[model samples]
Structure formats: C-alpha cells, structure tokens
Target: MLGRKLNDRYEIQALVGEGATAAVYRGLDLRLQRTVGIKLLLPYVDSTTRQRFQREAFSAAQLNHPNIMGIYDVGEEKDQNFLIVEYVEGEPLYSFIPSPPQVVAEYGRQICLALDYAHQKNVIHRDIKPANIHITPSGQVKIMDFGLAITPDSKRLTAMGRIIGTPAYLSPEQAQGLKLDYRTDLYSLGIVLYELATGVLPFDADDIGVLLLQQVKKTPKPPSELAPEIPPALEAVILKALEKEPQNRFTTAGEMAAALQIVLDGGADTRTTIQPAAAEPESAPLSAPAEAPHTGPIRVVLADDHRILRTSLAMFLDVNDDINVVGEADNGDQALEVVRDQQPDVLLLDLNMPGLGGLDILPQLRSNWPDVKVLVLTGRDEDVYIMRALRAGAHGYVLKTIGEDALVQAVRDVAQGNLVLGHGVAERVVQGFVGRAEVTSNVLTTLEHAILTGIAAGQTNDEIAQRLKLDPQIVGEELIELLDRMGTASRTEAALIALRRGWVALEDLHNIS
Candidate 1:
C-alpha cells in the first residue's frame, strides 16, 4: 500500500499512523505537486466503521480553522476508502506533559479556539485526547481526527448501548450513553489540561470499569497537589471545566477559552502553597461512596449455568462501588427464586439453563417482574437467539465475549432503563434481519419508515426530529441502531436502501422540509 496511487492522483509515500479503523500516511498529490496526509481505511473494519470514516470528512469539512486539521478530499477507489487531509509536521501533545501553567494554558487556549469554531458549526469532537493533538515546529497547535465528531443531524454510530469516547476522557453523560452537546468536548479538554498540568491522569486504573466510574463521580486531587506550581486561578479554571454536570461547567468552548486566557495573562506562577490533597491516592477518590451525592449502587442478580463463569462475572461487578452482585443462580428455577427474593434492579439471565429454560421463563419474568430489567448473556450470537431474547422483553443482549468494562456498563445501562446490544450482537442480528426482510415481507414500523425517509431526504438528526416532533437526541441514537440494522456504510447507502425497498418515496423525502 506504500507505493499505491489512489484516485489516480495521491500516491502513498510512507505510513505515519495506524489505528483500529484507519491508517494515516504521508502521500504526494501528483496533480498539485504537494505533500498531503492520507487516512486510509483498514480492510478488516465493518460497514459501520467505514461509515464513520466518511462521516469524519463530512463533519470536519464544514469548519475551516488554523488550529483544526484541514480536510482536502474524501475518495473511494474500488474497495479502499480514504480521507485526504493536510499533512502536519509536528509532535503529539502526549510527549510534553508536566509543562508549566503558562505553557499548559497557552496550548489549551488554542485548542479552545478550535473547539469554539467547531462547536459553533455544530460539530462535537466526541473523542478528544492528547494523542489527537499536535504541535508544529513553530508552536502552532493542530487538532486532528474528527472521526468521532457528531453533528446535530449526524447518525450516531453507537448501535445498541455502546458508549462513545475514550473512557479516561469521557464526560459523565458520554460515559452513561446519554445525550451529548458541545459541553462534552469541553469536559474532555478539561481532562487534557489536567493531565498537562500534572504528569498523571486524574483518574487511572488497570481496569476500565473502575476508570469509567471515577470519571463519572470521583473528584480529583487538586492539580496543585500533583504539581505545586499550578496557581489558584488556573486550578479553578481546570476544576470548573471538570464539573460533574454540564450546567456547572463552562457553557461554551469560547467561554472556557476566555478563562484560560486570563490565566495566561496572569504572568508567572509566584506562589508556593500546597493543600492537604497532596497526599491523595493515585486511583481512589477522597470522597467516600457513602458520602457521595449519587444514588445507591445498582443491585444485580447473575443467572448462568456455568459456576466458574458466573462466579468470575459476579466478582468483577461486585468490586465496583456503583454495582452490587446481590445473588447468583445456576439454574432456571434458582434464578426465579433468587430474583423473587432479591428483587434485583437487573437480572443477568443465561438462556441455556436447566428446568425452566431461560427462554421459557423470560415471558413469565416479564409478566411478574415488570420492574426487573432482564439482560440475557449467551455464548451463541445466532440471530434467532437475539431476536427471541429481545422480543421476549429482555432489555439487553450480550455474548460471553463481552469485555469486563462493557459487561459492567451493560448492567448499569439496563438498570437505568437503556437497551444494550453487545459483542457483535447488533451487527449480526441487524444484518440477518435486513437480509431476510424482503423475503419475509418484514414490515417496518411507522416511526422506522419515517426515519428512513428522513435519511433518504438527506435531513440531519435535528431536522428529522423536528419534523417527527421528537427529541433530536432520541432520533440520533435511533439512527445509529437503524443504520447498523440496514447494513449501510453511509447515509447514501441507507437512503439507497430506503429507495430500493420502496419504504421511502422519492418525492416524500424532500417533502419533509
């Protein structure tokens, strides 16, 4: 791929970056006789990731700013999809941690300006980390990778209950898979600033589960404690940005930039005072679980036939203060009894159990225990099983291959009344269903038809939500799941499907507006 010429123009020269979904390389534009950055999609990614890659181009192309990376073109040569961006010569921000307040504030102010520009244009950079930031030779900051950015009308990629963003930098809302706004980016930037002020992340753990919870509620040790040079004013700005609630934080990126600018103008750090938080633990928070403002931990009951698997999962969940594994049952009857007695907030049910089979008891549990959010765990990812579980009223479906953090979060999400699909369950089930829909004459619901038409008409999430008289956030989330089921790589694909299936009339699409 290093010497390949794409679109008969850009010739790949050298690979510079590689990630799970895409690889960025230095390329030469044969047409313009200039160097360009080419982000080529990796071959193994699914249609969803490919769509996201295209979405990055659409999302970022709307903004033109010095601090933001420039988008040149998006192309697809045969099966290879690639994005052309400005070739940046710089160092990543991760290498320069523990910088002084002046340097931190200076870099932060530039980031803030870029974010301000993007936010004004309705682009939310969901994944903001030090690695995504760069500093050129002359000290110009360049923010790269808009792959996770979201617009008001963009289709959300989290099919099922998948949460977005890096766990360490996730905002409370993002962690919970709730509606996000411009403030979410601000929260992530706050984390970057905090890490720059002190060499350590405010929240760090080998376990993703513990780290996610810390981001949501755990208060951080004062930056001054980690590095005594951070002034009171600078610390105040950083902490405010890290506020638990968006309402408590800066309303906009521009507002946060102004605060950072004040710190930059304050001259130099001339104080030498330290607080009691200097002795803070690296991972644990100062606030006790009992004293925290949030509600009690989510009560959960695990029901799996295998003892070892059930026991290990129980232990993993029980370790987190936000989750409690109240009981375990290895058989269907035992699960019924335990759930009846414990009345757990969530029931992690295994389908292949003895006596009353997991499938057999699903309807009974749904009828009797309406309050219990049932989540099915299975080793099989057959489409039939997923449909059966969900149709029987299970709130969440996950395979045994689910990661530790994802499993814990699934339980938490179910407890909060959210639907979850994990471990390729969504893509497999959605693809299977869509594949058979034409033959089976599977009818789409009215809302589903309307949404498909919205996409066909090229309307944004906000536009669709407005026309349907629903919340834009709800529409955005539903779009992600819908796209996954449609097996579409982009809006154009979704729109084409709707047109071919006759679910959306060519005229009706544009009629919405």
Candidate 2:
C-alpha cells in the first residue's frame, strides 16, 4: 500500500506506524499540496468503535491550541475510513523521561495550556500519559491520541466496571471507575510532572491490580524528596494536583501552568518567553537570529540520514570558494527548521529521511521558501520517484554516485533557477517521455546520435566507446553535453526523445545482425 492513493486525493507514500485501532501513513494531500498523517481505521472494527473514533476525531478537530495536534478532515471511501491529521514531526514525550526540572516545567506549561483549552471545551483526555504527548525538536508539546477522550455528554463505550486510562497516571477517581471531569486530567498531569522531574512514576507496581490499588490508596512522596533540585513552590503545585479528592487538585490547568511559569521565571511573574526546543546558539535566544546575511557565497543546507555522507559532502563543498555549507540535518523535520532559519540558496535533500521524507517537504519548501531551490540528492533511481520530485517543485535530481564536479555544477545551476540531473537520472527522464507523437529533428549531433543508439542497445560507455573507436571519457562527456544541448533534464528524457521520433526501439538493443 506504499504507493496507493486513498479517495483519489490523499496519496499514501509510506506507512509510518500501525496500532490495534488504525494504521498511520505519511501521505500527500493532492488538493492542498501539503503533507499529512492519515490514520486508517481497521475495517473489522465494530460500528460502535467506529462511531467512537469519529466522535473523538470530530471533537478534537474543534481544538486550535498550539499544543494540540490539529485534525484536518475525516471520511470514508469504498469501505476504508480515514482521518487526515497534521503530520507532527516529533518524538513521544516518553522518549525524554528523566528530564531536568526546568525542561519539565517548560514542556509541562505547554501541556497545561493545551489541557486548559481542551477542558474548557468539555473534553477530558482520559489517556494523558507520556505516550500521548509529543515533544517537537523546537520543544513544543503536542498532545495526541484522544481516542479515549471523554466529553461531558459521552456515553459509556466500555464494559461496565472495567477501567480505561493507563494505571500509572490514572487519578484516584479514574482508578475507582467513578465519574470523571477536568480535574482528573490535572491529576494525571501531576503524575507526568512527577515522572518528568524524578525519572520515576509516583506510584509503581508490576501487577495491574496492584497499580490500580496504589493509584487509589497510596500517598506519593514529594517530588523534591527524590529530585532535590525541584523548587519548593513547584513541588507544592505537584503535591496539590496529586490529592486523592478532585476538589483538592488545581481548579484549572491554567492555574497549574501559571505556577510552573513562576518556577521557570525564578519565582517572579516575569513570564519570560520559553524558547523552542531546537538546538540554540550558546548564550543566545532561539529567535534572535534572523536569516544569516548573505556574505557573497551560495549557502547550502545538507539533509540526509547518513552522517558520513553529510560530513564528507560538507568537507568537499567547504573548499569551494563559491559555496558555503551553512547547516546539516539528519531528519526531514530538522531539515525544515534548518532551511527556514538559514534561508540557504540551495537545499541538498535526501528522499527517505526520518519524520518527513524529501518528497514530503518539497511542497513546503515551494510554498514557504520558493526562492530557495531544492535539489534532491538521493540514491533513488526510479523514473517515478524522479518525476514526483520534479513535479513537486524540485529543481534538480542527483544521485549519490554523482561526481563532485557534476554535483557542484548542479548546485550552482539550480541556484540560478536551472534544472539539473545526473547522467543516469537523465536517461530515466528521457525514457519517461516515450509515446509522444510530436517530433523535433536534429536534437543530437551525428556522434551523439550513435551513442544514443548504442545506449538503447544496452551498451555501456566503454562498450560503445570501443565500438565507435572513441575514448570512453569523450563518449561520456559528449553524452552529458548532448543532454544539455537537447534541453532535456535527464538521460532517460533524452533517450525517450530518440525513441518517440523512431530513432531507437527496444528491438534495436539486441538486434545484432
């Protein structure tokens, strides 16, 4: 299903993950020309389950807080139900456990703001554990997975007497299977804060039965007792939220967020703005840097999963007097931040980076920074992939095997608004131009024509060179130059022009007489 198009608008690119309820995909919205996350509910789910899923999705769609994952659309097509959501490029909060008090407060404040907004709308995120929260590289907290969210008017969708929510973060009322309200979320937030500051859950037991009992009956140690670095006022907020009675907890998420804000501001109400989670300059605010002033060099950002490749490329490009390597990234999300912040003249992107792939970010690059040319530097050789990148606004497609000279020239060409393609990629592009009836004559010189015929005949440059009694390097250089003269982007496109004009055919490749 990697290449399947759903509902004829959302094109599925790759499966991001799968769960018991649904399979999530990284997809493209053809109508909007944007990347989105598509969650496809399992077809076998009962009607009640589907209704509940829709209810939760539709309910969450109303929320517009920065910390909440935005829902875009939901629909069913030919028996397949799906929800299109904002594709957040981040890691689950659980991945960042054992965080420092300041960092916890920074993230916790965002979560509280989200909860405040959600609860004000009469929505209670029943599952408020670490796994339900995502932390962006920019340090923003986005709450996700509202599948079990309960509204004030929600009807029971579970078996009677059975509890829902993770036992580790469950409020005492939730553990008792009693009625729930907004205060229950604050209790869970306290558990999350406790875990964040102390690196351990407030109550822990291996047995589910024991865990639930502990959540209901046990008193938790103060967070300061374990972490010692936690300030007294912040610890008081945690203790208040951990109270067994709902009335004893903070009345609203806003109050709790205010308390954390005070701790972050050194016990003052300065309300110092929190910086985004992305790596920052030493002793500088994240927003302090505007676009780096152009200093007479073509700036470039490298986005690839391979560190060795990025380092080698950076080293090679650094020597070029005309080019400067401004930033490097290992994932698509980081790539976006780097490119946005640096505003480089060229973005050397790979196709399959983590979070967001090369293709997924092309539309964004086109929309947000159209002046910054995108040159896909990837190992993908398929014509389909190349066409997709080019159509999605990539200015160039170069393979990893590209020589330093060609790559450097491609960067310079793309920065000047010219399309560039490596030799092998050029051939694929030509092949894709097959079956067109319109013909142009004399696009190739006599020697270049012979070389194209030999290439169609499955002859390598060396083989063709020996047959033509010419130097292989000369043959290769002529082929590359011929592609430029013919105004074709790739070798395949050049080859297809020959094929479409009846200059070559599949039978010619092996028709030795």
Candidate 3:
C-alpha cells in the first residue's frame, strides 16, 4: 500500500510491517501534517482473521493509556478495512538486544510498567513479544500491536486447536491448550527476558511440537545457572514468574514491580545476603598456599531437569581450564542436597525443575550459605522475570542461547562479586521505569480544558478566538502551550491526553461555567 492515498487524506509513505492478517504502513496525514500508522486488513484473510482485527481495534480504542499505542480511527472504504494509529518512530525491543546491560535493564522496567497499566485496564496483551514493544528515540517504551490482545469480557479469538503466539514464548498453559489469563502474558514475557539476558532461547528445538512439549512438560534452567553473576534474589524472581501455575506466579504486574524496586533499592532483604549454610566451609585461609598454588579446579554443581541439556552444559563447563563438574541434580530438591554436601563455587539452576523449582531453593541456599553466588539459566526471559529474579537475589541471568565464552565469563564475574545480566535483560528493566514516566505524563492541564471545551461546543479554534474576541494566533499559541505544559510533545499526544482525561467531553464540555 506504500505510495497509495486513502480517502485523499492519509498518504501511505512506506510499508512498516506485514503480519498474518494485516499490513502496517507509515502514512502522512495531509490535513494534520503529521505521520500516522495505518493497519490495513489483508484482502484474502479468512472471516476469523477479519473478526480478530476488528475486535482488536475496538478493544484497543477503549484504552487511553500513555504506555499503549493510541488508536485514532477505524474505518472501511472501497472493500478495505483499516485502523489508524499513532506512528511511533522507534525500534522494537528485539532490535535493542545485544546493546548493553544497563540499557536492557532500563528497557525491561518500562515494559513491566506498561504491562501493569494494561492489566489494570482489564487488557491482556496476548502477544507481549519484543516485536510488539516499541522503543522511541527519546528512550520511551510503548507497547503496540494489540491485534492479539484479550479483553476481559471478550470471547477467545483463536479456534480450539490453533496457537496464537511464537512457540518459544508460549506460556505453559498456552502450550497445554488450557484457559489463559494475565499470567499467560507474564510467562511469554519471561521468555523475552530470558532472551534479552542470554541472547538465547531457554528451550531450543528443531520442531514446534518439541518446543511446545518442553514448555508444557519440562522445566527450564535458571538464569543464574547460565549467567552466574545474576544475584540469587533476581533468580528467585525469574523462576517465580515462570511458575506453571498462575496462582504460583505474581498475581499482578504492580506487585512484581514493587518486588523489583525492593531489590534495586538495596533493601536489607536483598537476595545477595542469603544466610550461610549451617556447615559453613572453614573460611578460606586469607592466603592460600602461595607455593603449592590452588591444586584442583573450581568445582560447580549443575542442576536442571532436562537430562540431555543439563549433561551437555555440564560437559561443556568441565572442559574449561579452571572449572570442574562436581555433581548434578535433576530437580530443586536434589540441588539443595547436592549443595549441602558439595558446596561448589557455582550452582546452575533451572526454573521449572520438579518438586520445588530453582527459585524455591535460592533462599534455602542463602539461609545455608550466604556467600555462594547463584546464576540463573533459563529460557524464560521477560521484564517481570528479570525483575523478580533480581529481587530474589540471582547473581546474573543467562539464556541458554549465550555463547560459551559469555557463560564462562558470567561465572567468573559472579565469583568476583559483580552482577551480570544477559544481552537484553538490563535494557528491559530500565525501559520499565521509562514507561512509568510516560504513564505519568498522561495527566491533564488547565488550558487543555479550555481548548477541549471550545472544540466540544462545535467551535473551531478561529471561531472560538472570534467569539472570545482573541487573536487566532493567540488561541493557537495557547493550544500549543497547553500541549507543552501537559507534557505532550505533539498534537496527537495532546489529543490523546485530552480524550483520556475526559477534558474533551463533546457534549458535557459546553456545560462548563
């Protein structure tokens, strides 16, 4: 649709994205002199796809949130249906990975904030993957593409046997073909977080079926196990978010944010200060035998439920010059027992192990031995998971997809009292905070009330200026000033804020005294 004009108003400038049911275009609004995004339904789409697209537009239009991409107009013309939305000039979260740790943490935080707001609005972004998350040049994170969203009162869009999201990010409940809720989105986000940290999928498989099976029936390694520098507290949070049972996961995104805040604030309960094991190793002599040098290699206890993957990782680490595999466990319970006996420098944990997942064992390990640095190794990477893991005291988060060099470096970093995060984990956390700022910007201003009232009374800015016997330039200047004062950098932003704050009450604004 690029180069095409719709209704002689919006001129399509370029094709931005193409999806299963629709295509997105960057279009110029001639009258408004601004760019906007237009989502046009594909001509050959099935009835179901059309229905879903329409439903998405309707549901999304109801939400007036700063963190959410705004829907401006929905209409059909010449046998084509389309939805007009705010055009965000930014890269997707997926594109920002591999940048830097602090960037990833910041971005992740913004995502969490956006999710929290959407949840409060009774909206579940069924597809919370990186592609749907936009990061503006100013470092604002806005969640877009609600095409697959599930509204609180709406019926399911997909048919009985069809899957909705990417295989790698599907929640266990989604993989199992069961009913879903807000927690399902959290699970997908967990995968995103994992990828951000480690730049790898938790469960890498050749086939979709295998990936789905793993998601539904198998446990994933903890983020810390893969990247040792992740604090134990952070690992606990990640594992908790990946919980198969919704009830076991955080009930609300706000609670997850609060927990993360506690971790970042260096509260006394920080995961790093876990109590030492009862049989603390005789403190290492401050000076090891200088001449005899440390004899054996650094020992590590590898724990994960997937035998093949666990064994593979263990073998890989053992090949390193300074590392030796001391023991392995298939579940959290076994991991604890092994740690009690082995007391290795590192513990590789999986989030989904049987009988108390890795997170459940973190506090136990801390209570028993506070000094042991725990790294999480998992496929679940989402802002929520990253925050939770950090709060729970994980030393670092590494995805299975990370290279051997980075994985090994993570272990060394943790052992040296440094915090480590996988490729995109840190950015997401920071973005979550940015998103909070954007949400706060949605608040209203006094001048906005006057402009909205005038518009509501069917008076153009020029006409209103005439009625008030004021210069049109002054009125327009006032409107611009109002937008600036309200923290809306653009006209669209001002309009959206006004609409959301109920300042533009078409009927009621005229009643203003």
Could you give candidate 2's per-residue lDDT for residues 363-448 as a string of tens digits? Answer: 99999998898989998775446656776778778888877765776776567554566666544543343211123564444566
- Which ranges in model 3 have alpha carbons more than 4 Å from their true place? 98-101, 266-513
**Order of quality (lDDT):** 1, 2, 3
Between prediction 1 and prediction 3, which has the larger lDDT?
A: 1
Reference-based lDDT, each prediction:
0.76, 0.75, 0.66
Per-candidate TM vs. native?
A: 0.56, 0.52, 0.50
Error (Å) of candidate 1 at residue 137 is 1.3
In the range 1-513, model 1's lDDT, one tens digit per residue, is 889999899999986645445667889999999988888876645566777888888988998999998988999888888888888775667656767788788888889999999999999999888868876656678888887899856668873445555667888777656688999898899999999999889988643444556777689889999899898988998999999899999999999899988997787642222121123221110101111222357889999989998898888888887778999998889999998999998999998777776877888899999889898988866555666677678877898888776677677657756557785664454444434334334366556678888887778889888997655755776677677777765888978877888778878865775
Best by lDDT: 1
* Model number with the top TM-score: 1
Better candidate by TM-score, 1 or 2? 1
Residue pairs with backbone atoms closer than 3 Å in model 1 (clashes): 153-461
Worst 10 residues of 2 by lDDT: 282-291
